[model samples]
Target chain A: MSEPPQEQPRPEAEIDTPPRGLPQPEPAAQPPVPAADSGAAPGPGAGAAPVWGAGPPAPPTPQRRRASTVHVLQVIALVVGLVGTGWISSEHFRTVWLGSERDEPVAVDGAGAATHEGLTVSLVEATDLGATPSLPGTDWQPPSGFHAWRVVLDAESTNPDLFACDVALVDGGGRHFVANLFVDSFVDGFEWTFSCGVPEPDDDVPAQQALLVLVPADAEPTAVEITSTGFSSGYIELEID
Target chain B: MRRRWMIVGLAALAVVLGIATNVADARLLPYGPTSSTGAIGEDAGAYPFTVHVSQAQAAHTVLVCCRFETPPPTGTDGVWVVVTLSYATADRPRGASGTGLVLRSADGREFPVSNRTGSGGWLAGPDIWVRGDLAFEVAPDALEGLTLVFDPGIQLYGPMPTQYARIPLDLDPGAVLDVIELSEEQILGAGER
Candidate 1:
């Protein structure tokens, strides 16, 4: 028979400390066994193997690193694409189709006062010139001694009409210098030209206001009786020169 | 599925860019250039009479005639006239070659005309007038300067010029015409002179 079991515990066993007033715990130890006898239980060499976070630092896996790099590259490409598209769109609008042409009313003091027997005259304002008939990209330059201006006339029923514009040289003077201008009449409408006086010693005759009148071969147009011209119902561009 | 979406997005972007580029180019193009193949005259059946472009050149000279049953009016606003030119592009022409208009008398003398005018009323007669640099034709590989000559005395409402003719133009040798068109309109609210 086995010797009677000793009731006293061994003194070599140790207990963990109880910090301050915490309870003490007994040391727990696992028993080591041979693999063959322990039914494939962990042997001495098995438990020594390392886990992912418990070994020497390892370089990132090829699969993970490749995935991260691809994601970062894709993000960079997206940002660049957005920026490039935005830049191109902005350039197109800012430098291309957007145009700056404006029509303002200019008063031509006296447009059709001269009435030579053979000459018939009418007046038209050069506002909205962009809408007039002409070769694209053409610009009008005033003739020498002409100040640029526009007029409104009574072209209510005139055809084959030629345009002549004038402004008073002296305040309240009866004589007016004609502006170098021309307009052609067609069934649809009309377009005209006006000269801003030449550069040197420019005529500084201030127009009393913008004015227009129509003169037929037989009729002499006066400043006050002038009515209106095409499209520009009552617009004018007066130059004081 | 994500890759397909990305491809579609890129394609859409490409299309947008193409359209924008086209619009930009159009904006930069010049205005209407004068034409070369058309003629300016009355509709064959509209007026009691008809007008023809008898000649054109650096100084265009057209023949006037009355081709109708009723005679042209001899009063004001009875006849209106103008000369129109055609070009390849509608753009501002270049140089001092773009100025000057003069009405020539039967005597072959030229009068400096300030601008286009409305005769107090239409007058009837087969008369010729001349306008310069005011008309031009811009064609590929060539810029044609033109002068339009017509009868300013005939009214648009009353009658057409009495003589039949062709527009005489002073153009370079071997230069051919492209197109030109012309018409007349009654003044708003105005009676025939």
Candidate 2:
């Protein structure tokens, strides 16, 4: 009553103070620090304390989370892609190294002997018969535009059983020529001998055979290939001079 | 580190499995029989039938004096070889076609059976004992170390590996083969020795 006791003005610091039991607003830069003296449990209370400051801690700066997720996805894709590429490359190499190797003929020097499956073959000599070559006993002559070649070889069988083989000539242009069959008169007259199949080899000597091949005059023989009749993969090749 | 080891283990397993598959595929492929030769009178089982060579003779000429539904062409001048065989089937009887007789000289010349001579012995079905003669014409000088090769007919679809029954016709180098004549009835009926 003496002029309503003349209410006194509050101090500035007291005017700015928040009410009790309400959360205090923290600075924008620093998150609110939890009260260690308080009896609250650790984990849930610590998480809630950050939410009370600066409007939920600015949603944890979404850039870092998104960037980490993208990084993990990129790593997974890279690993999967690398495994797939490696598998494909390995298969390609396997086929090239093993599967496709048979198409190439086995290479041997002109004087070397090539062996396969208990059989050995060597080219002794190759003779090119010029045009108008004479037959030993017959008056017959080779057809025009065709030339003859006589191939001499030694075939030895190391196995106890008999061995049969085939002979073919590969020209420089990759053409194959078989032994002449139609010129029986000349073959029979010349006394030229060939072993169709070799008997078991003796300790001292192997069977020697001769073949007569007729080819066009322009063909140039590069190699002679010998193969077993039953198997196509195994072969013996001897280069010609 | 454990995950890395797991990945490496899986990769190794994949490679092993691939190699195993390749090996299995190679092993399972169909292969032909190895080339083989047998003597006369030996039972050379060429599948579906068994072949036996009883006798071989060399002759200067072959005369087909037999009656025929279709008489074969006549052969002259060249040396003739007569080969006798008894073909029998064990389980299933099969009719066979084509000639499998070939004459091989010591120098590796091959002369097939002559179609000119008439021999009525054709292949028949199972349990049937068929005997007949096949004649081949060759040069007179080709008689030494003459061998008759019997092979089964070739298969068009699969591998055609030839197994030969080599019957040595031990003809004297200087011996003269006489001219022989056979009647059509004698040739058609089980051949006369």
TM-score of each: 0.25, 0.33
Cα lDDT tens digits for candidate 2, A40-65? 57643354434333332355568989
The model with the greatest TM-score is 2
- Candidate 1 stretches greater than 4 Å from native: A1-60, A84-180, A183-241, B1-5, B12-193
- lDDT (Cα, tens digit) per residue for candidate 2, span B26-73: 454332232335556665555445566676777777766565553443
DockQ of each: 0.02, 0.01
Q: Over all chains combined, what TM-score does candidate 2 have?
A: 0.33
Docking class of 1: incorrect
